[model samples]
Target: MSPMETGLIGIGALFVLMVLRTPVAFAMLITGYFGMLVLEGSRAAGAVMLTESYSTVSNYNLIVVPMFILLGNIASAAGFSRGLYDAAFAWVGRFRGGLASSSVLGCAIFSAVSGSSVATAITIGKVALPEMKRLGYQDALSTGSIAAGGTLGFLIPPSTGFVLYAILTEQSIGRLFMAGILPGLLLMAAFIGTIALIATINPEAGPRGARVPLGQKFRVLVQSAPLIGIISISIGGIYAGVFTPVEASAIGAGLVLLLAFAMRQLSWNGFCRAILETVRTSAMLYMVVIGANVLNPFLAVTHIPETLGNAMVGLGLGPYGTLAIIILAYVVLGMFLDGLSMLVVTIPIIYPVILQMGFDPIWFGVVAVIVIEMGMITPPVGLNVFVVKGVAQDVPMTTVFKGVMPFLLAMIVSLLLIIIFPQIATLLPDLMFS
Candidate 1:
């Protein structure tokens, strides 16, 4: 068979492997290994394929990944979740839909440390759902907000997914990290606006609580000092060039560990749990990555990207039509695939085509992330939504989904706004990273 035909079949096999519940890394690795042998024969495939496993892992920029994940786990275990909720609540919890709004703020801040969406959603849900419920918020709005807000983890700086993207695309991780800042903030703003609109339309969905006392508000703000300090040190250090990405991550992880120990939150058992989970997650991610590295080359050998780029350029459809098709593709795949995997699987194919057609990769990354954000909230396999579902089981899945409807629409509009005004995504990274 032609290498292109074989490559296409390998793609089908990978998808089947995923659906059959094989580990994604294994699926990618096993498929990638044989596919290479099929295309390039035994000796050549063995030489290059063996090297990718460690070489890909050893890149200094990639070290930031585990540090970020460990930092997130430690922060969550160390009471960062409560601190974030308290700070957000002190200011926003008295307004109509206030508790729901607080969930959004909490997720955004939580995302700064915890770049994992499911982790972010589940952690914040445990802390915020009861608070919202006790404050007379409906389960639909409360859980839905937590689920929707969790999607911010990927859009924010320090996103593990974005890190993976930067590595995959060979872009400067710092620049992509900078690009995500404004888009993340914009997404949060859109969520808040949607909450206000919902509360206004149906006040019964969310009822207000009493205003926090001035002194109490200050106290809550004070409680967040550790989080603010850690976040500032880590992100600030990276931006200022005080440390490399890996160094910033390592420093953040160490600080979180010390903070957890000081706060009496880091027990022997919790510490053990954190390390094990980190290893497991890291292994899974690395496996898929190595697979993609091999698989990517295999695809490139087919000239698929070049061929597809030419085909798209040949199409009579204008720019908007191309954009629409890409967006539509994301929405469809999102129903089943998790966001990060979807991005990694699709972007390598789509990006070259995009750049060849004059779309900015940075702008495309933001635009791509926004579409994946929809996946995080969309049903069936929405990872964030499922995390919240695991938290608030009393609420039916449909209601949680229904409650997120307006936010989903708002998220789409946010994407449109970002696309229409490219500056929204580019401004921060351009100005700061400039």
Candidate 2:
């Protein structure tokens, strides 16, 4: 059979396995190994699988995964999330719809520590949802803001999404981390603006809360200073050339753990729990990366990506037009696949096309993450929406989904602005690294 024919069949088998509820990592592994066997026999396939799996996990750069995950788990266990929310609320909870805005602000701040979107949503949602509800804020606005804000986790520094993208595309993780800073903040602002618009249209949706006194606000900020310091060290340290991504992760994790110990907020059991959770999450990510590595070789042997890229180039559509189609595909796939799955499944195929079009890899990393963030709040499989629903159990799924819609729009606008200017995502990395 032609390589194209074999590649198409392999892809079909992959989707079938996914539909059967097999884990995406295992599905990719099975499809890739079996395809390699068919194309190059058992000996070659076995060697490829073993080599890819070993080399992938053994890579020094990937240590950042566990370190950063540990940092987030430790921070969550130590109750820094509550401090972040309190500080944001003290500063923003007084304006009309300020409670919702505070939720967004808190999520953005917490995202600096926690890289997982669900973690950000759950952390901020636990702290902010009850307060918003107490203030008579509409369920949609309250839930929507948290869900949308949680997505900042995917776009901000310390992002696992960017890590995966960097590894897969062979780009510099530090540059991608820097690139995300501006766009992440821009999207956060868009979400805050979105809440204000919702409040303006219907004042009852978001009533103002009691204003915080200047002294109390300063006190809350002081309480949250450790978190602020951690963010500055981890993200700021990287930008300032003081730490590589790996060093930054290690430093961040150690500091958060020490802070937890100093505050006596985390018991020994809680410390062990954080370590165990970090191991579990890191192992899962490693397995997925191994699967992607194995599958990438198989796809290369099939010449699938080249064929796809050449086919795309032949269509005569300019780069932007082709980009639109790719983004649209992500939108459709987001309805079914989680963000990481979408990245592992598509990046090998799409990234070659992107590079061929003369786009900067670092910039595309930001663009791709923003699109995935949109997916986290989109319908049918909006992971963050469901996460917020889990927190706000009394809020209907429909209301949560409705609330997320405006934030989703804000994300789209943010995406467009980044596209039109490009520098919003690239300038920081260029200035810092170049």
Residue-wise C-alpha lDDT for candidate 2, range 1-434, written one tens digit per residue? 98778888999999899889899999999999999999999999999899999999898889888998898889989999999889988998898899999889998988888888988999889988998888899999999999999999998988999999999999999999999999999998999999898899999999998989999999999999987898899989999999999999999999998888998999999899999999989999999999999899889999989998999999999899889999999999999989999999999999999999899989999999999999999999999999999999999999999989988888889999999999998899999978
lDDT string for model 1 (1-434, tens) is: 98778878988998998899886667777777788788888875786577877778887788888888898887876677888888998899899998899989999998989887888899889998987878778777888789889989988878887788887888877777778888899899989988888898899888987899999999999889887799889888877878767788899999989989988878888888888888887777777778778667767776777777778778956666777888999999999898867977887788887787687788888888889989988988888777888888888888888877788998988998988999987886687677
* lDDT assessment of candidate 2: 0.92
lDDT of each: 0.83, 0.92
Q: Please list the residue runs of candidate 2 whose C-alpha ends up more than 4 Å from where it truly belongs after superposition.
A: none
Every model's Cα RMSD, please? 1.4, 0.8
Model 2 Cα shift for residue 49 (angstroms)? 0.8
Best by lDDT: 2
- Ten contiguous residues with the weakest lDDT in model 2: 2-11
